[model samples]
Target: MMITSRNTAKAALFLILTFFSAASLWLLLEAEFLAITLILIYVGAVMVLFMFVIKMLDTDQSTLRAQFTRYLPLGIFVSIIVIAQIVLVLNAGQFDIAMTGIPEKHDASYSNITAIAEQLYTLYVYPFELAAILLLIAIIAAITLVHRNESRSKKQNISEQINVQAKDRMRIVSIKPKSAKESK
Candidate 1:
């Protein structure tokens, strides 16, 4: 649905559905933490961001619909091929428990989150830190790209403000007061 949707908002909605489905699969695998994280990160934060971007873009729906119609046949063909491949792989009988053994159950004290953190901070720490730095740079680049310095917009000059004197902004006007309306 997401691939076929012409409307960006609809596509985002479909993506949210996909995220939820993935979270559901995680739950089926008894990975509650992963399921919640997926929902919170992808569905909550990312989907909201996507929706805001879609609204801000205000894309021409007519053009999107036209393009969708143009490439729909190709999309359908690719989708069919993908589905066929998945079916063939599933029917290959290599995924049975006999072939892939049963998963070992951990003790009651075992914590997947702790184990994941250990692995992440141990084996993958450098890559994780690199990814964080890259994300930070990307965020800074995005902010810089969107920061417009328009001449018409007011901007504070700290140096000028600090150097300004009261006299520069204020003037005293002298006016003679009337003597009780000339003693009227």
Candidate 2:
């Protein structure tokens, strides 16, 4: 019933290997942004969260493979199917994606990130702006949900809040000296 450091180290190693595999896939797909995000978000945030939860639970053992006994045969079957599909895909040759390495010549128009950005804003502007709006909403919602009011401040009703004007908070009463000076 005790957790061992060896199991923890193994888990850490497995997570790192998974992250690297995913990052390698992103690179193969020519998606630089996705590869970087995978490393940053998965390796950085999710792995850190995993370690924190594990440490908090003081786990000496994991129930990952042991708890899912009923699904093991199905899992193996599905994994075999997936591996077969991947093999088929790798062996199929439909797309001509290679450049035959012949001497090439072209106008020098593809020099910098600016050119790519300009094309993206013009050609893919709608999706780009939509993504920005989505990200903005996500950020705002995250901020709103995270900052809960845990303080024990007195709660006021809506009518009370609306009725309380500036006069309730402050008052400027006429002084007795001003009245006496007027009489004199």
Q: Candidate 1's residue-wise lDDT over 48-117, tens digit each?
A: 9989888899698677767878898999999999999999998899988889887677667877788778
lDDT of each: 0.88, 0.72
Candidate 1 residue 56 C-alpha distance from true site, Å: 2.2
Residue 43 error, candidate 2, Å: 4.4
Per-residue lDDT of candidate 2, residues 51-150 (tens digit): 7776777554455546668898998999999999988886776433563343344345633346557878999999999999999999999987766674
Deviating ranges (above 4 Å) for candidate 2: 1-50, 57-62, 94-112, 136-184
Measured by TM-score, the strongest candidate is 1
- As a TM-score, model 1 comes out at 0.65
Q: Which ranges of candidate 1 are over 4 A from the true structure? A: 1-10, 73-99, 147-174, 177-184
